[model samples]
Target: MTGALAVAEKVPEPLSKAKTNIVFATIVLGMLLAALDQTIVSTALPTIVADLGEAGRMAWVVTAYLLAEAVATALAGKLGDLFGRKLIFQLSALIFIVGSMIAGLANGMTLLIIARGIQGFGAGGLMVTAMALIADTIPLRQRGKYQGALGAVFGVTTVIGPTLGGLFTDHASWRWCFYVNVPVAVIMIAMAARTIPRMRAVVKPIIDYAGIGLVAAGVSCLILGLEWGGQEYPWGSPMIIGLFAAAVVLLATFVAVELQAREPMLPMGLFRSRVFTVCSILSFIVGFAMLGSMTYLPAYLQYVNGVSATVSGVRTLPLVVGLFVTSIISGQVVGQTGRYKYFPIVGTLVMALGLYLMSTMGRTTSVWLESLYMLVLGLGLGLTMQVLTIVVQNTVPYAQLGTATSGVAFFRTVGSAFGTAIFGTLYTDQIGPNLTDALMQVRVVSPEVAANPQSLRALPTEVSAPIIDAYADSIDHVFLWVVPVALAGFVVAWFLKEVPLRDSARAGATDVGEGFSMPEPSDRLVYLERAVSDTMRKARAEGPVAPRILADAGSDLSRGEAWALGQVYLHTRIRGAATLDAIAEVHKLPDEVIEPIYDRVIGRGFLTEDAGGLRLTDTGRAEVDRIRASWQRWLGARLDDWDCSDPADRALLDQALANIAAKILDEQAREQEVAHV
Candidate 1:
């Protein structure tokens, strides 16, 4: 045991600052590949349709990818936990590269759609695993900065996707859009192989294939119904009706299965927390508005404003700028203040206002006015986007951290799919009749030209004016319908309870290593209380007890001195001086290192040096009591609603809580001993 402790102490910590930055950069690259792919093909769709001669089926390209991505995201995190994150991450990147290559070489619309589905599947895995890896690697206190920067990447890629697609379609081939992911994915795969740590579930792995199948089928059916209704099939048609019915039945089955599964993919228990439920709903709404708006805005600009595809992409910059700036600022503020509830509330309200403004836009609305509306919408999404994930991470137990994080992401992707589908339905329903009527009055445009929006700019002014007005009116109505969605999100944000963020270094130590261990809830509570105390002290500018004070007190204690003091105080009260010597000897540390820490405590009046060796003064005893109280309060907050009606279970919890407090003191003593050496 002594030799093992000595060797463990000698091992350096796994993640240094430079390594963290490198892994973070690799994560961001993987995330960008996924995020950018979501929108990059939008500008190339027309070219693809023209070449493939399938004008009516163009929407399927986007829909297929989204559907597949949503399913992949829903399962990726659990697979990572079961298998191992590094292996899954690498596999996901490789899949993405293969899918991208297949897409680039696709010659038919059907083949392209299949390729896109493959790409989406790979992209989905990349996104969820990348996010889970971040939680695994980075400490929570500093995660916001990296997460915020990732949000910026999403914004930049979203804004530029269309422009880049347009440039490639015009100057090069439309295939480049898919080809673009290959090199970036390759680079990500390389970095991940070298930098990402191996982490796997400590518990025995169980495959929840039934739960996975039910949920995937349920979500797939739901999206398919939404996509085909009012476009390919009537709302009352049997196909749509059957799809919706299957969705409900399958989803219910999934819930039932989760209750019994040894390791369910998405644990239903997490939804018991009000914070998790509210943030999830908010995430859904944000995805709805953000993606729905992005889908239609460019079409509105090109058809109504008579702009080229590239020009339309460039004009949407204000929205991206607003989103990028606010996301970073919000993340930074939350990191510093540890207050997050306000941002989402204000964000949703602003989003509703922006959608309302967009609803009011008409055929004659100036470009500047439209840009201003987009900026407002972007700002609202920015504030809401990154914060919800951060909140989910903060509240969930480390055991469910990956599952919870991916669950929130899965909702957002599902929301985006539904939003785009419904928005398309509304636009097509409104535009079909209006365009037909306008063409009858002015025969300048052929039915072919009217069917293909890409050719709308080629029509003369007299013929295109009515068509433009029809498009503007249809898009305005789509925006009007979404106002309610954003408003619902705003109301839900009000119910989000603000929980204090946990310190990553203390609470997340287990998260970083190879073997997973589920610490008892009471053990976690003890660590949580100590972390909270450290945060409070730092916030009050009273942290990192001065080295000079240690020197003045004739002790060579390090920053870990408080922990050592607490240990000495605990040992003297319980098992006597023999326990202290045992601890030092077992850890293979000299007695002098342990002795000075107590000497410092004695000098500070928290302890007294006497013939008995050492004893806690009144102040020291009071401090220990305070630590106990803090742990009790933290545990109470977490377990308030937990069922404890059985006396045996309740007693077990009580004993565990008391044991954890002592365990914390012992662990700190060991760490301090190493630091002093």
Candidate 2:
């Protein structure tokens, strides 16, 4: 994980730009469907209710879709890590088209809900696979712009969803809401099948079944509790309480199970990263506020404000427009400058301000004013939302990219669910009594309307206005509550320490601040110092650390030559393979120079050479063995640098070098093996 494999200088010549674009377009279209489906159903609910006669089950339509999607997101990311993104993506597209067809042709509400769940599953795969593939294709430096384009796609889809839903429901049929996916999915599937290059699967990790079970059980229970508690059951109902308790136990068991597993679904080491932990927290908070608020906003516009579905669709444009502009700008800035900490800092602050501004809205407040508030909030969200993903991915090594990114996505979904439930409760508690009071004043309430609070919206204007006003008041309070959550996100954004974005191909090759070359070793000075020290140690009353005071200093070379040559004699002596006195004579030096080399070599008993010169003694051979052993240890410590297949062999080579060094000195060879493998 520490070292990166070097990338080829360019992609293979056989790959064409047209093929690459086709692949890219497929991913984009898939992502568009996922983002659009999240909001599209809200605009078509009325028509769906009239056809199916299940207005009471309306919330489940969206809840079931989201719940299925959330599970698929994490699962798809894991599958891509084990298999290949191209394969999973193609399969997901096929599943999506099939689900869309089923939903479009369904007769009953139950069947349609099940079909939506299937559609949600496909959406999840589409999102995770699309994002992960982008990372694989693009370099980190250029990825920001591509990620920005994804954000733009999401923004456009969010605005388009409601409008498209209204057009389908008003002019044709509510079934088109489901059918619209067919053609787009078919195109995307064909594009993907034609363009994405085939790849073999990686060696799969040992599957941790117990950990998977606990995670699935835990998240499912928790999400169900949030989705059902306020609407289908009371807050303190036994079923709700039991589900919450089950979630806690299952989640705790998941952690324990993963810790014990040899190959964990979620690696515990990921938590060791401070930035990853903080990013997960921020993602959760953002999801909680964004998804939860967006879920009920359409209801407020239609049921509370007497607006048609088309008008509500048009009115939400400001939010999407704000997101589009800010997302693109932030992406460009982050890519060019390589400094992104400030965007989130500024964004979270503005988001909190916008939430605070939204809390001030009343039933009679100006429509433009509300739009302005949403626009501000959307812009702030756009800047911060994707930036955290960038920071988290940047903090980890490339092999774990899909896992880390999906982990953030999973936490965000949890936050969104919790946010929706809490706000749902707050709205119900505040609106119910105010609605009753408003109806009493109008004096036209029926038993059914009183019993089913949802029916109050269909009453005459005189009877419904006051009740709708109460909804506006309560929803504003929900926004007021969200301000604090947004503020907490701002605090979380503060701790992200910006590390330099390194190019993956060059990650472990060299220090970025310096050029690629390593300095050559200077062994001449090492031998010179060793010789001088040995001479002094051997001399009982040596004058100084000078070379001549000791005997054996010029055993092969003459004193005069040793004296004149000084330290330069060490390199010359070794190269010539000469005796101590002969080397000294050749350089025309005194014992002072060559004496050091002779004394040191003799003392260490490692001066190996031929009969033509002084050779290593038995003790010198042992010393060489010790040096080789030390070198082997040094190389062993850096085994992580070796690739999977090479580590054991590299360690063996290091040990072999050590043995060779030792054997040469032991045999007192005239020629020594220095540092060869």
Per lDDT, the best of the predicted structures is: 1
Candidate 2 per-residue C-alpha lDDT over 1-677 given as tens digits, one digit per residue, 9 for 90 to 100: 10011111111112334554566677789888887887787767655765675444555567667666776775675576457677888788878888788889989888887888888888888877776555445332233345446645666677888878767776788789889899998888888777766542334434566876788778778867765676679869999999999999999999988788875666677789998888888877777777666766765666565666666667777766776567667765665566778777788888899888888877677898989998998888777775666566567543444456567767776676567656666665666577678777777775345333346657777777776676678778888888888888899889877775422211211111111011111111111112222222233243422222113122343322223222222333334444566544543446465465556555544455566555545654343334445434432332223222445434433433343222212211111111110
**What TM-score does candidate 2 get on C-alpha atoms?**
0.66
Candidate 2 residue runs with Cα over 4 Å from true position: 1-13, 46-59, 80-87, 105-112, 131-151, 190-197, 205-212, 332-339, 397-399, 428-437, 443-461, 498-677
Local error of candidate 2 at 630, Å?
30
> Clash number for model 2?
24
Give the range of the ten consecutive residues with the poorest summed lDDT in model 1. Answer: 514-523
Q: Please write out the lDDT profile of model 1 over residues 161-206, one tens digit for every residue.
A: 8888777776788899999888888888889889887766544345
lDDT of 1: 0.69
TM-score of each: 0.72, 0.66
Per-candidate clashes come to: 0, 24
Best by TM-score: 1
Compared with the true structure, the alpha-carbon lDDT of candidate 2 equals: 0.60
